[model samples]
Target chain A: MKHTLPILIRKEVTQFRRNKVLPRIVVMMPLMLVLVLPLVTQMDVKNISVAFIDHDRSPLTLRMESHLAHSNYFRLCEPVGSFEEAEQMLDDGKVDLVVSIPEHFERHLTLGDPKPILLEANAVNATKGAQGMQYALQTIASAAMEKARGRGAAIGAEQLLTVENRYNPTGNYRHFMLPALMIVLLILVCCFLPLLNIMTEKEHGTIEQINVTPVGRLEFILAKLIPYWLLALVLLAVAMLLAWAVYGLLPAGAAALVFLAAFLFALCISGFAVTIANISDTMQQAIFVMFFFVMFFMLMSGLFTPIDSMPRWAQGITYAFPPRYVIDVFRSVYLKGTLFAELWFDFLMLTLLAVVFNLLATVTYKKQS
Target chain B: MDNIITVSNLTKQFGSFTAVDHITFAVSRGEIFGFLGANGAGKTTAMRMLCGLSKPTSGSGSVAGYDLRTQGEQIKRHIGYMSQRFSLYEDLTVAENMELYGGIYGLSRREVSDRVDQLLTALQFADHRDDLVGSLPLGWKQKLAFMVATVHRPELVFLDEPTGGVDPITRRQFWDLIRAAAAQGTTIFVTTHYMDEAEYCHRISIMVDGQIRALDTPAVLRARYGADTMEQVFYRLAREAKRGD
Candidate 1:
C-alpha cells in the first residue's frame, strides 16, 4: 500500500495532465467560479425602476408623487399620462412597476378611507419586480399619513442600525462565491475524474489488467482513489489560496481543519463517482450520470439563496446532498472564523458521508458477479 | 506438470441466462491453454469467473491453489491478465507504468526499480524508459501492456483477445513474449479467434454457445475434423453449430 501510493498519484497526475479538459474542468473552473461568476451575479433587491400616472391633479396626489421621488427603494422612470402609456413602457421593458393614483384620489382620502392606488406589478422575474411594486406602495402610504395628520405630532426617529451579513461582512461577492465554488469545483474535478477514469478502463478493457494482477478488489479501488483524491485536495488548496490572495478572504478556522474536511469530502464525492463508473459501460453514459448529479447538487446546494428562502421540502431535500454539508463547513470557517466545535455537526455529517460512500462502492464492486 | 488452474461445473448467470454453463477443465503449469469462441459466445464470461472479476452463480474453481469462491483475495494475489486493447497507461512513461503495476502488486520500491531495469535492458529499449507509452507504436504498447501485466510474477495469466488489433508481425512478437513467460513457468490462459494464434497454444478449446465443442491440441483438432488447417477446423465447427441452431 505504501509503495503503491506515490505510484498511483503520479500516474493520475500524468493522465490528468494529458487530458486537456479534465484539469480545467476541475481546478480552473472552480477558481473562475469564485472569481468571475459572483462579481456580476446580482443578489440585492433594491431600487426598482417604476413609472407613475397621477391624473388626479390634486394636492394629495402631488404629495404622493414627491414621496415616491424620495423613497430609496424606487427610481420612478419617466412618468406617463394614462394607464395605457404606463403599460406600453412596461412592455418596452422601461418600467417594472406601474403605479396609478386614481382620479377620485382626493375624494377617497377625505372620506378617511381611500380607494386603493392601482399597482400593476410585473411578476415575470419573480423577485425584483415584486419587490419594486411593494416599495412603491409603502412610499405612497407614508405620504398619505403625512397629509391626513398635520405637522408637529411626528413619531420620533428610532435608530435601527444593527446589521452583520454572516459570510460577507465587507459584502464581497468573490468572498461569498469563491468559498462555495471551491466545493463545487473540487467535486466537479474529483468526482468526474474517477468516473471517466474507470469507464475509460472498462471501455478499453484495461479492467481485465487489474483483475488478473496481484492487486485485489480493495487494492484496485484504493489505487484509483489515490490520484483523484490527491488532485481534489490540491485543487481545494489552490482554490482556498486563490480566495485568500485575490479576495482577502482568509480561512477563519485553522487551514489544516478546512483541508481535512475538504479532503474527506473528496473521498465521499469520488466514491460516488467511481461507483457510477463501475456500472457505466461507456464514457457517454458515465458523463450523462455525472452531469445529472452535478447540476442537481450545484443548483440546490443553498450557495446562492438562504435555506430559509427555500420551500420547507426543498430545504429538507438538500440535506441528502453531500455538498450541502461541505458548503456549510466552508462558509462557517471562511466567513465567521468558526472553530471546529461550532461546526462539529457539519464535519461529522461529511465524515459519515465519506464512510458510507466508500463502503457502498466497495460492496457494490466484485470481480465478475 | 502440476495443475495450475482447476474448474468444476463453474457457472455464471445474468438473471436466467447462464453465460458459462456447468463445465470442467484444468490447465497444467507452463501450458498455453486457449479459450476460443465467437463474439458473445461466453468465452470472456468463463475467463472472468476464473480470474475472480465476477462471482460464479453455482460452481467453483481454484486459481493458483486459492478457492475462487471463498478466497478471491488469495486468487488475485497470484494471477495476471491482459486485455485486447492498449492497456498500458498512455500518459505515463513505460518505466512509470511498470512501477505502478509493480507497486500495486506489493513490490518494494527498490524491487520495482530492479525489475523495471531488468525489463528495459532485456527489451533493449533502455533509452525509451522515460518516454510516454502513448507516443510509442501500437506494437510497443501491446508488448508493454503484456509486460506490465506480468510484472508482479503471478502464477497464471489470462490474455483476452490480446492481439485483436495488431498486425500479424506484432502478434507474432506478442506470442514470443507469451512463450517466454511460459518458459519461465507461468501458465497462460488465452482466448483468440485467430486460428494461427491458436495453432501456437499447447492445447485449444473451441466453445460455441457456452459449451466447449472441441478440446485438443491444434494438430489433433485438425486431424479429428479432417481439416488441413486450424482455420478449416474452426470454420467446419462454426458451420455445424449454425446449422444445428
Candidate 2:
C-alpha cells in the first residue's frame, strides 16, 4: 500500500499531462479569473449619464451642472431646453438621470426662500437609478452650500455626520472579490477536476483494473487527491501573484495563513468531490451532481454575495458548506490582516470537514460487492 | 496436482435472481481451465467469486491458499483479473500501463522496468512501447491488457471473455499467449464464446442455467455425448436451458 500511492499519483499526472483540455484550463482559468475578470465584475455602479434642464440659467445652477459633470459618478449630455426634452432622453435610455432647475431658482435662494430642484432618474435598472439619483442630490447640495458660503451665510449641518469605510479605505469592489476568486479557482481545480478524473475512469472501465489489485482504498483515494491538492496550491500561488501583479492586491496578513486555509479547503473539497464520484455511475451523472453542489458552493458561500446580508435561514445553510468558512478566512486575512489566532474557529471547521469527507470517500468506494 | 482454486456449493444472487446457483468445482495449479457458457450462464460470476472480486451468496471457497470469505485481500495479491470489458488505461503508454500494474502489485522499479522490457520485446512491439494504448489496434489492446494483468506474475489470472470482438486469427494469437502463460506455471481460468477455443483448454466446463451441465476434457465430453464436435455436445445440453440470454 505504501508503494502503491506514488505509482497511482504518477499515473494520474501522466494522464493529466496527456489530456488536452484539462491542462489548458489549468493555465487559462487563473489568468482569466484573476487578471481579467476582476476588471469586469466590479459591483460598484459608475458611468451614469445625466441631462440638465437649466430654466433659470443662473450661475449657481450652472455650477451645479459643472460639479455633477466633474464628479466620477456622472457624465453630462447636451443641455436640454425643457423638462419634457430631458424626460425624452431618459425614456429613450439616452441618459440615466435628468436634473431640472426651475425658473428664477437662484433669485429665491438669494432671498433665503429656496425653490426645490427637481431630479428625475430613469429607474429601469434599480441600482443605477437609485445610486445615480443619490449622487446627483449630493453634488447639487454641495454646490448650493458653496453659493451660500460666498454670501457669508454659515452652513451648520455639514459637520453633523462623518463616514469612514473600514478594511478597504476606498471601498473597492475588486479587493473584496479577489480573495473570493481564488476560492473559485480552488474549487474548479481541486474539486471539479478530480471528480471528473474519477468519473472518466469509471466511464472507461479503467478503475476495475485498479480495484482488482491489492491496493488499499485509502491509498487509491489519497493518490487521486494528492496530485490535485498540490496542483490547486500551485494554482492558488499563481492566482495570488497575478492578483498582486495585475491588481496590486496582496494579503495584509501572513501569506502562510492564506495557504494553510487553502490547503485544508483543498482536502475538504476534493474528498467531497470523490465521494460524489463514487456514488455516480457515469460521467454525466457525476458532472450534473457536482455542478449542482458547486453552484451552491460558489453562490451561497459568500464568494459573490455577503453571508451576513443573507436571510437567517439562508445564512444557516452556509454553515454546512465548507467553502463558506474558508472564503471567510480568505477575505479576512486578505483584506483585514486577520491572524490565525482570530481564525482558529474557521481552521477547526475546515479540519473537521476534511476529516469527515475523506472518511466518506474511503468508506464509500467498494472494491468488492 | 495441488488445487489452486476450490469451491463447494458456491452461489451468488442479485435479489431474487440467482446469477450463479449452487455449484462446485476445483482447478489444479498450472491447468488451463475453460469456463464455457452462453450469454448470462454465470461463467463470469463464478470466475469473479474465485478471483475475490465479488462475495458469494453462500459458499465455502479458497483461491491461492486464501479463504474466499476471510482473506480476500490476500487472494487479491496472488491473482490478477481481466474483465469482459477492455480495462487498461487508454491514455497511457504501453510501458506505463505495464509499469503501473506491476507497481501496484508491489514490484520494484527495477523489476517493473525489466518486465516492461521483456514484454515489449516478447510482444514484438518494442518500438511501440511508448505509443498510447488508445492508438493501438483493439486486438493489440486486448493482448496488452492480458500482458499487464500478469506483469506482477500472479499464480492465477482470470480472463472473462478476453477475446469477445477480435477476429479468429487474433483470438488464436490470444490463446497462444494463454498457453504460454500456463506453460510458465500460471493457472489460466478463462471464458470464451467459441467452442473451438475450448479445444485448447486442458479441461472445459459447460454451464447452463447457473449449473455446471458437463465438466471434462473436450474429447471426453464429445465422446461421452456421442457427438462429433464440442459444439454439438454443448448444444445438446444448452438447448434444454430455459434462459437464452
Candidate 3:
C-alpha cells in the first residue's frame, strides 16, 4: 500500500508470462538469432563457379585449371571450347566467372612476357562478383609465379608483402554478428515489448481505469518500464550464453561493461518506446511510429555495416541514434576487447539518450487531460 | 444528510463545440444520483470532469471534498470510477484484477485478499476467482468492474453507462449491488441510457445538447411534465433537442 510500483510491476510480469506468443517469442527469438543467423548473414563469399576456356591447353593452363579446381573458392565447370560458350555459361547463371587463357599463355611465361588472361564475371551480385574475381586473380598470379620461379625468374618470397589480421585473427563473421544480434534482441525486447504492452492497455480501455487511480504518472511509467528492462537484460544473458555455447564467442573485454552498456540502452529504448506510446492513442499509430524510427535506427546505426564507410551525412545522422552508441560499445567490447575508459563517450551518449527519452515519457504521459 | 458532491456551472468545451454547458447539481450523502442523457448529450463528459479524469474548460466544483480543478489526485483517492468500456484487464484473473485496483488505491495486501474472498464468496463464484476476466460473461465482468471500483470504499463512486448491454435479470442484480453500496452511505453517480433504471435513483438529471433540461426525483419529474411514465417525461424534454446521436 505504501508504493504501487511493486504491484504494478507484478501485474505486467504476470501478463507477460501469461501471454500466448510473447513468452515463446522472447525465448525463441534470441536462440534462433544466435544459433541460425550467424551462418546465413556471413560476408565471407565462397562457392564460385568458373568456366574455363582453355585455348592454350598447355600443361600450365591445365595446371592453372587444376589449381583453381583444388582451391575451395572456385568450382570448375567442364572446360568450354570458346569464350562464347563460357560467356553463355555466365549468362545462364551456371557459372559466376569465365577464364579465357590465351593461345601462347605458357609460351609467353617462358619468354618472361606473360599474356593477360581474360577474366569475365557476372557483376549483378556485386560483392560475390568482386570477391570471386579477386580470388581468381590471386590464384592465377601465384600459379604464374610458380612457373616463373621454375624458370629462375627473380621473384623472391621477400618481394610479396606479409599481412597479419589482428584482434579477430581469422576474421570470423559470427564473432562480429554475435554482439550486433544481441543489440537487435534488445531493440525487440526493450523497445517493442514495452510499446506493445502500453498500447494493449489503451486498446483494452484498462489505461483509463489506471488514469483514475491515485497512482502517480511517474510511478505508472516506472512500473511499465521496469519489467521490460529486466527482461532485456535476461535475454542479453541468454544471447551471450548461446554465443559462447554455439559459436565459442565470448566478450573480449569485461562482461560487466557489456551488461552496463545493455542496461543503459535498454533504459533509452524502452523509455523512447513509452514516450511514443504516450503520444499515440491507437496501436496502429504507436506501431507505425515506432517502426519508422526503429527501422532508421537499426538500418543506419552501423549494425550490419560500418558507419565510417557510409556517406558523411548518413554517418552524422547515425550519431543521433541511441543504438549506434550501444552497438559501438558492444562491438568494441566483444571484438576489440575495449575497456570502459576507451568507451566512456559511447556510455555517456547512451546515458544522455536514456535521460532524455525517460524525461519525455514522464512529461508526455498525462494522467488527466 | 451532508452534501457529498457540490458542482456549480461546470462547463467543458472542445474547440467550438460545448460538450458540457454550465451544468450544476449536488448530491447528498447516501443518495443515488442518476445522470441520464442521450448519445452525445455530454453525460460522460460531465462525469469525467467530476471524476477528475478530464478538466472542465471553466467552472468551480468539488468532488468528495477535494477541489475538482486543483486537487485531482486527492479527489481520485477519495472517489471511485468505472468507465463505460470494460476496463478490467482481460488477461488477469478475477482475483488479480481486484487486487490490482485495491493496491492502486493504497489498500494493504491482507485487506485486498480478505475483500476479494468476501466478494467472490458473496457472488457464489469463489471457484472462478482464478479464471481470467475475459473468460467471464459480460454481465459478470460489469458486476466485477463495479466491485473493483468500490474496493477502496471511497465516499463517492462514478459509473459511466455501467449497464449498456446486459440481460434484464443481470441488470437488476447490478442495481441491487448499487442499492447496497448506497445503503452504506456511498454516493452513487451513475450514467445510463435505460429509462427504467432511472426510476431506481433517489434523484435523476436529464441532459440534452450539453445542457441539463431536467433534475428531480423520477415521480416528481413525471408529475411536472404531465406524463405517466419516466420514459414519457424523458421524451417530452429530449424531443425538443436539435442534436441527435
Q: For model 1, what TM-score is found for chain B?
A: 0.94
> Candidate 2 chain A — worst ten consecutive residues by lDDT sum?
A155-164
lDDT of 2 by residue, B1-245 (tens): 79999999999999998988888999999999999988888998888888777899998989999999989899999998999999999899999999999999999999999999998788898999999999999999999999998999999999999999998899989998999999999999999988898899999999999999899999999999999998999899888888869
lDDT of 3 by residue, A1-369 (tens): 456999999998899899999889888988888999989999877889999888898877888888899998889988688888788888899999999999888898667576878999999999899979888887876776676668686875643323345888876878888888899999999889889989999899899999998888888888888888888899899899989988788889999999999999999999899999999989999999999998998889989988898999999988789989999999899988998999999999999999998899988998877
Question: DockQ-based ranking, best first?
Answer: 2, 3, 1
In order of TM-score, best first, we have 3, 2, 1
* TM-score of model number 3: 0.93
Greater DockQ among 1 and 2 belongs to: 2
lDDT of 3 by residue, B1-245 (tens): 68889989999999999999999889888899999888899999999998888988998988788898999999999999999999999999999999999999988999999999988887788999999999999999999999999999989999999999989999999999999899988999999889889999999999999999999999999999999998998888888878878
In candidate 2, which residue pairs get closer than 3 Å at backbone N, Cα or C atoms, i.e. clash?
A: none
The regions of model 2 sitting more than 4 angstroms off are A53-62, A78-89, A99-120, A137-163
Query: What DockQ do the predictions score, one after another?
Result: 0.62, 0.82, 0.77
- CAPRI verdict (incorrect, acceptable, medium, high) for model 2: high
Listed per model, the TM-scores of chain A against the true chain A are: 0.77, 0.88, 0.89
- The model with the greatest TM-score is 3
| DockQ-better candidate, 1 vs 3 | 3
